[model samples]
Structures are given as C-alpha cells and as structure tokens.
Target: MKYDVAVLGAGMVGVCVAIHLLQQGRSVLLMDRNDAGEETSYGNAGLLQQEAVRPYEFPHEPSVLLPAAFNLRLDVRYHLTALPKLIQPLWSYFRHCSPRRYESIAQEYGHIINMTLACHQELISAAGAEQLIRKVGWISLYRTAKGRHKGLRTLDAYTRQGVNFKVLNGDELAEIEPAIKGHHAGGVHWQDPWIAGHPGQLVKAYTNLFKQLGGVFVQGDAGSLKRSHQQSWQLRDHQDTLLEVDEIVIALGPWSAEITARFGYRPPMFFKRGYHMHYQYPAGQPRLTRAVQDSEKGYMMTPMDAGLRICTGAELGLRDTPSTPVQIDRAEAIARKLIPLGERLDAEPWRGARPCIPDMKPIIGPLPGAPGLWCAFGHGHQGFTMGPATGKLLAAMMTGQTTDIDMSGFRAERFKKP
Candidate 1:
C-alpha cells in the first residue's frame, strides 16, 4: 500500500505531524516500533512550558561547571566513557551558551515556545482530552534564602519578557502547599504553562483522533527506509510487509539521527537521558495540588495519575547504555523531606532520552538534497510541548502554504560546516 507521507515515529511529534498532514488532506501512515507516547514523550515532567522563553543553557561558571564535571552533582551526571564521543557536541553546546549567542538562540527558541499553549489547546479541544490537562502551572521551589535570591535574579529577565509568575515567600509557599514539610525560602509559580496528569494518555487521545480522521498507525522499523525505483520511499512493517510513500518525515526523536546518518546527513545530535519514578501518598498525607520542582536539588515532583512522579535532571550517557539512576536516588531522598511519599508505585525507574541540538533549536524542515524527505527532531526538552506547533509548521511547509512563524532559525543546515 502507498501513503502520501510516512511519519516514522509514533511519539508526540510524529503523531502530531500525522494529524496535521491528515487535516491537510494527505494520507499519512504513522509508524513506530512501540506504541505512541510510550518513549520520551511518556516520562517527562508533564509541563507544556509556555513560560520557558529561554532554552536551558550550559553553565560556564566554576561554581556550576566544576561540580557537574567532577561528578559531584546530583542534577547532572556524565559517564566518563561517553565524554570522548560527546566532547565535540558538548563543546559546541557550550560555545552556543555564550551570553551573546545564547540570547540570539533564546529569541529564536522563544518563538516556538510562545506557540505551545495555543497549539496544544487546539489539539486538546479537538481530541476532547481536557480532563488530562490542568491549568494551574508548575512551581519552582527553593529551600534556602540564597537560592530564592538567585531565583529572583533570574525572574527579572523573564519578567522583562512578559512571563507571568508569582513570587511566594516561605509563609506563602506553605499556605499554598501545606503538605510540604521543608524549611523552604520561597518559590516562583510560573502561571503560563499547563500540566498533564497523564501525558501518555493525552498522546493516545491525539492518536485516536488521528485514526478517526482517516490516518493509519502501523508498527514498523523506520531504519528499513529506502528509496524505491519510482523515487518513493519504501519500508517494511512489523510483519515484513512492504509499504511505500511519496514523502517521509523523520520524527523518530532520539533515534532520528540514525536514519538521517543513513541518508548521509549528519546533524550534530545528542541525547540527555532522564529518569522518573512514581510514589503514592501515605494515609492522611495531603495530596499535591501542583507540580513542584526542587530547584536547588534538580528534580521535579508532579501529581500524576499513577501517583506523585519524581523526575530527575539530565544525564549524559550513550542511549543504549545501562541505566545509572543515581539522580533518581538523590532526588527521592530530597523529595521525601519535602513531601510525604509512601510506597513506590513502579517497581523500577522509567528512563528516556531527550533529543537535543547544540544550537538550542529544533531541526524542522526539508532535508536538503533529499527530495520528498523532511526532518523534524532534536527538540531537546520541548518535544511534547512543541509537537503540535512543529507539526503545523512542517505541514504548512510541505503543503506550500505560508508558515505561521519564521522558519529560518530552525533549518537543518545550520549545523553544516562552510
């Protein structure tokens, strides 16, 4: 069978791409090895971060870099073995984090971040998944007066950018979340973003909406993609059944680099692995009404459908390497002091790799020199947040329509050497 486009990933981004293409009267085949949203899309902090105007930058200060480099920090851990392979991309990432370059990247990234809420809203309303969404935004909690002061300093820039936030003191923070038992200094409640109770379920809802609108979902290996005699792309499904398509979209998240490399396009791609574990509240312990991030400790706890999910920060390692969940262990220790967490819901920690680019922008456009091929990956931490917006942009470009925003900054050729 033939399709107008074969989206080679069933995560949030690929599913959104398929939905957008289907809406534009294109026959889309959404293919994935696993079920939709069960990968990186499943185990995030579940934040649709509208207020995250700036992308996360590499810290250059000795205070921050020394600890992370020497493996003395719980927030960021790097495998010494992976450093040899990762140095090039990490250096580029650090170079991009220079104040001048970082500002430019932030402006470019903010364009996409600004569109997240509206795009997600459209899909949420269309898919009737309002029950999964919570408008009460996430909070960044600080345990020390010095940390709160630093947070206030950071807020000035966001405030200048018109990001909405409420500065809560220790008393006010306690008032809002009385269950928290830490001697907290304060918090910054970012009011622009939305939280998801079950992020995977939200993606499933969108997938169901796509299927209802005549899109097809198939289990297939995207690595099998090849150009056929008729200049169309062909790939075999799980049953080894061949399927062909006129156009193909590489939205395979962290796995996208493998497919792109096969096509002789090497965009500097890296992955930041993270882990999450859910815990239920003990009897008489108050339930958390909002998702909270322990800013200094570098972990977040969200009220998930399974239970209170404790998610860790970035871990630099090979994608297929054995899970070293040291961050989860540290986060759990700190989280226990903040809130009463009872029994662990998941027997094991769930880990996923986030696809990232050094320039802090996603590669979302056509693959240069590869006709009928498109690339959309390297979303870093915002894949789930920016999926719909990116899908609409990619669909617009594919259909030869006017894009809603500028596409120059997100081109795939940005990483190319002159």
Candidate 2:
C-alpha cells in the first residue's frame, strides 16, 4: 500500500518521528534493519539529560589533547587508521569548539533541549510507560577539589540556561548514597533528568505505541531508498516493493549520512563510539539509588534493571573498527573500587556510535534540492533525550505547522556547500 510517508531507521529518533506523523493522521511505514531501539538506542547509560544544554566539545587544552592523542586517556581514544578519513570533520569540530562558536551552538541546542523532557513525558504518559522511568536524577562524582571546582564552573554555564543542580559535600554525598565510596571531593546532583531501567525497552514501548496507533513497520535497507519519476519516495526489500510515499525521513542515526549523501546532502559527520557493559553485584553489596558519573574518569556507573551499567567515554574511529575496549577495561577497574561492580553479565561489551556533526547541532528539517526528502539524525550523545522533541519539531516542519522552538540553524542545508 502507498503510505503518506516512510521513516527510515527505527531507533529512538525514527520511531518518535513515525509516531508523531501517525498521530498527525499520516500513514507512516517505519523501516529499519533491526527491531526498534535494538541498535545504538539500546546500550546507553539511560539518562534523559535535561541539563545537556552544552554540546560535547573537543579538548582545547594541551594537557587534555596530548593524553587523548596518544590514547593515554580512558575517556577518549582514536584509531590510527580512522584519522585520515576524519581529519576534515574533526578539524571543523575543533573550530566549532571555540568559545564563541560553542556558545552559539549551545543557544540553538538549548532551544530544542528545553523541549525534550516535556516531549518525552507526553509520549511516556500516552504510551503508559511510566513504570519504565525513574524521576530521580544522576550524580556527578568529583574525584578532587580541583575537579569539583572545574565541574561547578562548567555547570554554572548550564545553570544560566535554567538547569537545576545541587552541590553535595563529601559527607552529604556519602550519606545519600552509602554504597558509593571513593576519594570524592564533592558531587553535583543534577535534579532534572530521568533514569531508564532499560533504555532499549523504552524505545520498544514507544514503538509499540506507534504500532497501536496504526503505524506500519517493515524491515528494509534504507540505503536502497530512492525517488521515482512521479516524485514519490519508494522503498524496497530485495526487489519486493515495501512502500511508496510522498515524503521520507532519514533517521538512521550513525548510518544517516550514507543515505543523505546519495542525494547530494553530505553532512560533515563523525562518529563517537561508546562502550557499556553490565556487571552483577555480590549478594550483600549495597545497591546504588541512581547513576553516578566519575566526573574526571570518563565513565559512569548506572543502576539498571539488568545490573550496574558501566558506560565508557568516546572513541574516535571507523564504525566497523575492531573492538579495542581499553576504556571499558580501564573504567571497570575504577568502578570496582567506587561501587560493587562484580562479574560482568555480558560475554562481550556493547559498542555504538553517536552520530555527531561538525557544528555540534543535529540536522533536522528537509534536504535542499531533494524535495519531500528529509533528514533527522546526527543527534550525537543526546539522541535519546532529544528524540521526542525532534519528532515533535520535524513533524511540525513536515506538516507546515509552527514549531515549538526556533529551528532555523538546524537543517540539512546548513551542511550543504554553497
């Protein structure tokens, strides 16, 4: 059957897009190679960050850059082979990290981030997935007084954008979370975000909601998407016609650029590969009430339904690079000392890429010169947090309605060369 629109990629972003379109009375066929949220959306720390106003930046300081360059730092790593392909976009990313440009990007980002919590809440309430979420926020553990001061300084910037956080002294921190023990100077408890027991299940809940609302889902290769002479978007699965639609949204997360480039829309994209693994605690071990991030250590231990999830920092490399889980190994060593992170639950670590663009903002809205073709990936680290907001915004843009936030700077054409 001919659908009104086809959304490629059934990750958090794409699923949300399909649901929003379906709610707007459009016949949406949600296509993905894997089940909804089974890919990058599955293996996150599971925090819906409302305080993520500032985009993650490249290290400008020589001390930070030098260690990261040699792969000495656990928070950041790079492959020697991936450097050549990434140099241009990485350089652009560096330039955007400049204080002036970063501030500008944050302003645009905050506009959308400000709407994320409410958007997700609306969907969660509708989907009856309230049991999947915990309103309790997360803690940022500072290992040193200097690190605490630096974290506060960074947090102060977010506070200007209305982010709420409470500073906890060593004694107060220990009192609140007795399970946590380390040489922590202090902690900043961000009181805005929500914790997900299972990040993938949350996506599935949303996807199920979409299905209940009459959205169609199919397994199809988004890379093979094409436009017919009649200006309709056609999707195929091994020569079997799956869908024909008036519009399509490419929300394939890390793989989004592969489809966008085919239509002459090449977003200067880079991938930040992150690792996470769950660990089983001993029988008598104290339970963590929430997720705790080692502020200086580039890792966070989140209490999930599965176990305490230890998530590592960014790895700059090709998407299909061999698993060099040095950060996971190093972060596990640090986590075991802080909390009771016993034996690993998984045989292998889960790795996924954050689809990052050079300018530190996601690409939304329609593609230039490719009418009826839209783009919705490049969310980087905040995809889960911002997916509903993106869905709401993109749906509005697609339907010619007013968006809740100003969506001028965020569009696929921004990356297109003049």
lDDT of each: 0.91, 0.90
lDDT of 1 by residue, 351-371 (tens): 999898988789999987788
Lowest summed-lDDT stretch of 10 residues in model 1?
A: 409-418
lDDT of 2 at 150: 82
Query: What's the CA error at residue 253 for candidate 1, in Å?
Result: 0.4
Q: Which candidate is the best by lDDT?
A: 1
Candidate 2: Cα lDDT at 183: 48
Error of 2 at 323 (Å): 1.2
CA RMSD (A), model 2:
1.2
